[model samples]
Target: MLRITTLLLILVAISSCSNKKTETEPLTAEHKAKIVGLSKDLIKSINDFDFSIVNSTWSNKAFKDRVSNITGTQKSVFEHIFEKDLKRKIKTGNLSIIHHINSTNGAASFFNLDHKDHHSELTILLTYNDNFNFFKYRIEIENQKPVLSDSYNFRDNLWYSEKIINSLRLASKHNAFSNDRRETNIAIHNSDQELLKGDTLEALYYLYDIPTTHQTGNWLSFRKLTLAQSLSDSVYASVMVTEYENNKSLYMKYLYHLYFSDSTDLEKVYDILSEELGESKTLDSLVSSGSFWD
Candidate 1:
């Protein structure tokens, strides 16, 4: 019995030690350096419009499987498509890595690539795997990109209006709208005014202020609040909004469709509001106060 007890204690100690190691072990400087070097090389390749480097940067099995699943195309055909896409990006200009976050197994790097006209910028996110191999990336374009905006000038406004209307309607169905209807009406009216004035970000905030019962999850309210707050700096809005949209949480998707749909009309009031509200406040406080609508 004594020997058995000692063995059990020893096993427990070993397990505790293993857990501590895992919990405390952070990515080493060497690992971070490796990730940074890999990221630089990948960005350089992209700027040079050399798709061949992808053959080395990407894990062959993973890339091949993903492309096959998505397009039902063989590796050669997918490479051709990828090359075309890279060429288009090259036309924009060289890409520069601006920020990165490294993890034990991988890293995510943010890049800013200038537009062809050099007037605007596009943000790209590259996600790598444990092997320091890139497996995915997302490029966010301006909503007013020539191809989409030229053909449909007012599409963004229309989309925003529709979303607000639909969300309000849903809230009503759930009896989430307040009895006074004053707040709800004000929200709709203010949003409309901002939309017409081309202050898209403020318009979104007005729509965000409509109070809903907590039981209903107030999904739209939370989503729009997050979006409005993030849009305080319109230059980084696309990247921030895209990251939230891609978040695995289903509630986060409510505002995903709002991004890259139109050019934001700059609002001077954004700075004032951001300052007044205290930019670092948690999302819950922002939603509860409803000061943004005021």
Candidate 2:
């Protein structure tokens, strides 16, 4: 009788543990729908330039704190920032939600922005507590989104760029014995000129096209390490590290590289270009004329 009771107790405990595991599993379809709905609503608010709606989407304290930190005021000053900094060049009609993903602790929405004369992308990330009350949110934009270096083709471009750079480096090392050193030098110069004439984002995109072999991992790791060493700004490093922690994607790393090379905030760079070239005009003229990096 005693043995039977002990066995029954063990069985019940095991069943209860299994049930708990099932209950704590990741998001279901219902959760996804809820997250997607929130994202769509936020995009709609942006299109309408309705701050009331935008204000409602964000947590009051978090939104206020961020605005205050940036503007040095506790009042709601996001409208001015949104208008001049973001919406000035944006074609609200072309804004569309491209993707949304939910994690155990939060969710993120990716948006494609086809501005009047250029294309860009935005990412909105939200983090919430267990009760589902979001405590923090962030919106990041990548201006002048590279045509060929988009998420779909980024890997291929990186692979190709890696091959080109590696070949050039190898040729230089063996140039002491090679009579064709002049040819290698010409190749290097031509490649540099090509890069100078191309979009900076596109140049960085080539890094993603490298083939994934055993050496690829080592090569990327070394590049990342080198990039970290090159950055003099601790704040930027901190931000990049946080972003990497949240989204461990190759595309994100590429964006970090671009940021490092440019050494300027993405939005500021866009704003400067917009002012110089006119917001109503297209970037095609500048992009086609010569490389902005040059």
Task: After superposing candidate 1 on the true structure, give the runs of residues whose Cα lies further than 4 Å from its correct spot.
Answer: 23-35, 45-251, 254-294
lDDT of 1: 0.38
- Colliding residue pairs in candidate 1: none
The clash count for each model shown is: 0, 13
Candidate 2 structure quality by residue, lDDT tens digits, 1-294: 999999999976764443231111243444444445554666455444444444333332222222221211211234444446433322231222111112243343233332222222223322233211101123211221111111112222232223333443444444545645544344445544546885333333343333232122234443443444444467347646645454444445545655576544433544453453234233333334432321
Cα lDDT tens digits for candidate 1, 14-39: 64443231111233444334444544
Against the true structure, what is each candidate's TM-score?
0.22, 0.20
What does each candidate score in C-alpha RMSD?
A: 20.2, 22.1
lDDT of 1 at 127: 37
